[model samples]
Target chain A: MTGVRLYFRYLGVSFRSQLQYPASFIMMTVGHLVVTAIEFFGLWALFDRFGSLGDWALAEVALFYGMVHVAFAIAEAAARGFDVLHRHVRTGDFDRILLRPRSTVLQVMGLEFQLMRIGRFTQGFVVLIWGISKVGIVWTLPKYLLMALSILGGCFLFVGLFVLQAVLSFWSVDSLEVVNLTTYGGVETAKVPIAIYKGWFRRFFTWIIPLATINYFPLMAVLDHQDPLNTPLWLSWLSPFFGIAFFTMSLQVWKMGLKYYHSTGS
Target chain B: MAQIVVRDLTKVFKVAHRKAGVWQAIKGLVKREYNPVRALDGVSFEVGRGELVGYLGPNGAGKSTTVKILSGILVPDSGLCKIINRIPWQERAAHVQDIGVVFGQRSQLWWDLPVMDSFELLRDIYRLGPVDFNDTLEELVETLNLSAFLGVPVRQLSLGQRMRCELTASLLHRPKLLFLDEPTIGLDAVSKLVVRDFIKRLNKEHGTTILLTTHDMDDVEALCHRVMIIGRGQILMEGKLKDIRQRFARERRFIVELGNRYVEEEVKGRISKAELIYLEGNQAHFNFDPTIVTPAELLHELSAEFEVRDVLIENPPIDEVIARLYEELAI
Candidate 1:
């Protein structure tokens, strides 16, 4: 109970701090909204011109885009400290975090709750609800639960990616751009249906990175059809678990990186 | 048992040697080389409760490294360090609950928020109860003179005010031990005095054991009862301030002024061994080796020979003594 209350207090302080510069906060929020909207607009233009990708329709693509953005926004808003770990490490601010009585993970999570991402969050949410209304399918309770879980799972997955990115700073600070190929690049690539991609790429996203679990499997479940690749019916429901597992594994890696950091004094 | 103890602590860092240029970065990834830098090599120290000890060393001399290890921020590669009966790294969360740390170069206070907000965040971070938190807050605000700046954003506060707030934030939980690394660096003389004075009062009143690492010798002299000189990852000397000076500065400085400006003449006997540090016409300053002669005898000899007007004696600067001690010990 105390821990939960403390977490809320941490968020409250972060919100107040960000609010100190209301104009900058508003500008950044709108900028994120505009920036994220461009990607969806590009997708909409492509669909309007060609009509569909393979057999996937506009609403199906929206589902993929909406779900992934929701996950990314949550992680971007809630786990921003991990995204900016390099700054903290370079400035030796991470040392102060260690001095605190709280766990480093919890403390870093509480480092910021970027209200700026709300711009992107609201945009993604609007697109999702719009897609839901336009699809015009019978919505069942289990499918609804799976939809919610998919978003939750996606949140953990991206957070895990952010954690991995943060862990790399413990060693070398250079080539951080390469790690971005996995995170921002992953989000960009995951926007499309997994079926349109080649076999190896599909396998990589499905079994390796598990991008399909967050979107395609749940989408297939919602569409009430068996996936052509014969991935088990239950597997789509487990998409969120991939993210959780990946995040847990990344946390382990993060701990190992911390140990290495202590030994190396970096 | 000591409140803090370390046995043969050592920390070695492997620095990756990276090649320059885009092409080199690509090639270097496949075949990288690493060089090892030993930061702390077989270092040892022990501190008792309520003892304000100064940990001094030159830049890159492992001063901050030692403080980091003791405070549980970093782990030593090969050694045993126990603070307050706990291994700092192994049980970090528990270990840090009773320890407060301040890095003067950085402000732990939230940069954009008011100082009071930072304090409240710290209260939550440490999970102090309402009554205890209020009590500590009220006492700290009054003693540290933070009322004028508490409501102001940390970014707007002057360096001195920010430092005072930092001190209050760190002490709100009332930890048993406080680790201050360069807590007075880059502050005005008044601010430095305020920080030093507050530290003195805190130590005197609360009996909080403090291990202060600083480049400022005055802070050491003013606050620390004992000083430890470290260099090259080793303890060179640790003792009372007076005792360390006596060991290094074996001479006493003597200043003399004549009734009138006159041609300088060489003095014989005890004053000859004394080095002439300064000479302005009739007024001359000589630093005599105390082992060979005493201040009284030297003054008597100088008074008897020359038509002296006034005389004054002083000790060498502690910084010079410490420098010489470091050289002598090869620390």
Candidate 2:
């Protein structure tokens, strides 16, 4: 069987086991939806009071929020194993993974499939549709394609961050708060327009971490809006590729960490 | 030909040194000391195909470290090691495809999933086809008697039951080589026997090369034909079980139960070339070399002097032999 088929099999087993506790599953899913909804409502109230933040309006900011959450939800669900990799490392379950015949990354990816994250995704989906309706952007085949690519790129970016966090477990089993600062902090920061942040913070997100590549730049291309910070339109369209690049780079770091684990026996 | 050959395999670990107290902890954050521990110091051994070799050692004697390196989960700092003609750490995926490992302390089975579900997932992980998987699964289930709790979740099962399922899970792939790291640890007599029996059959029937690392002497006596003793990160002794017994079996024990109360003078006068190791009201224990005086002569001498009501002649227990060996080697 192909790796993809095997991954789905893992997903099937994981989901079935999780479903064994129907009450807990339902409660967690609803709780996740409620918490995320409250967060969005807080943003909605801020937009209601301010009307517009500089050049960005409520709908434009909603587009950014929706894209980031949707991508984050999908990545968090699919890459749930990497998100909690410290537990596996600390408990020595990672040794079992190394014993398998499959690729470590693929096996780790298949370790979990958080079905409850569907609640978060659903909220993001509803908000995205509402934002599209309110923004009044004319729908076209190319525009829709760009939007799909942007969402996928955003998912890859978050997954990359998760993979990086997991790789750190090889060196230290403690779950560092710094990684959360980047991952959770990235999502909260990216939900707002990049132009509103300080110049250094904006540049850091753009060049170092590339959080803007998935949301801000792709949104600019989709909305046909000029960059408020005066960047080229073509560069904005290329932002989605940065997500793929970041993901690929993170994988190399993961490989190095695996090598370190093998030699050090940590 | 040997199925596994490890020569001069050495691994040194840099363990961080952490001192107690808030000031030391603060200092550790800035600059920490690392002490080098030689987990495997030029260890070397070999196991032929279809051979059940017992790898024995006391705690921190590098038994688990050797198993990890042999199974490809760890890489040695120096020396050559090969399993089935493949360098384990170099071609780990391919090497591990034909190998299975079980760590007694850790469960590879899913905690919340049924035993059957974990088996099915393992089937998929190993990519076994439907017909072949069914055939192998049926044989393992029947042999290991996993039908009773196949539907039960692993967390709910008893330790013995979970261990049986764990054994079955590892063999579903029908790996040519199996590494059992203390497979019978913390098991009752019945569960230990069941596991040992299954492992014996698996080795005989499937011709799987089995390397068992265990602290349980009974496990070694029951399952292994050949035994390797390791001490201080090195192979101290490697030979057949019978050879070890013969090497350490020079002294024999005799327990003679006297009809009347024990007499020290009578016991001393009759038993020559034998030291009375222990004495009670009516029973006396003697340690004597069989070569010096045969059991018949010793029995005759004791009976002729003292009114011996019963005589029990036995060899020392395997644990004593192992303990003595460890002490002598200063491991």
Question: Per-candidate TM vs. native?
Answer: 0.95, 0.97
lDDT of 2 by residue, A110-185 (tens): 8889999999999988888889889888878887777788889888989999999999988876446779887889
CAPRI-wise, candidate 2 is medium
Any runs in candidate 1 off by more than 4 Å, and if so which? B18-28, B259-271, B303-305
What DockQ values do the models have?
A: 0.75, 0.79
| lDDT of each residue in A1-266, candidate 1, tens digit only | 26678778888998998889899999999999999998789999999999988877788778888888888898889898888888888888888888887878888888878988888788888888888888778988988899899999989988988888988887767757887887788788788778878899888877777778788888888977556687777887777788899889989998998897777656
Among these predictions, the greatest TM-score belongs to: 2
TM-score of predicted chain A against the true chain A, for each candidate? 0.96, 0.97
Please give the distance, in angstroms, between residue B326's alpha carbon in candidate 2 and its true position after superposition: 0.6
Interface RMSD of 2: 0.9
**TM-score of predicted structure 2:** 0.97
Taking every candidate in turn, the Cα RMSD to the unseen true structure, in Å, is 2.1, 1.6
Where does the lowest 10-residue lDDT sum fall in candidate 1 chain B?
B262-271
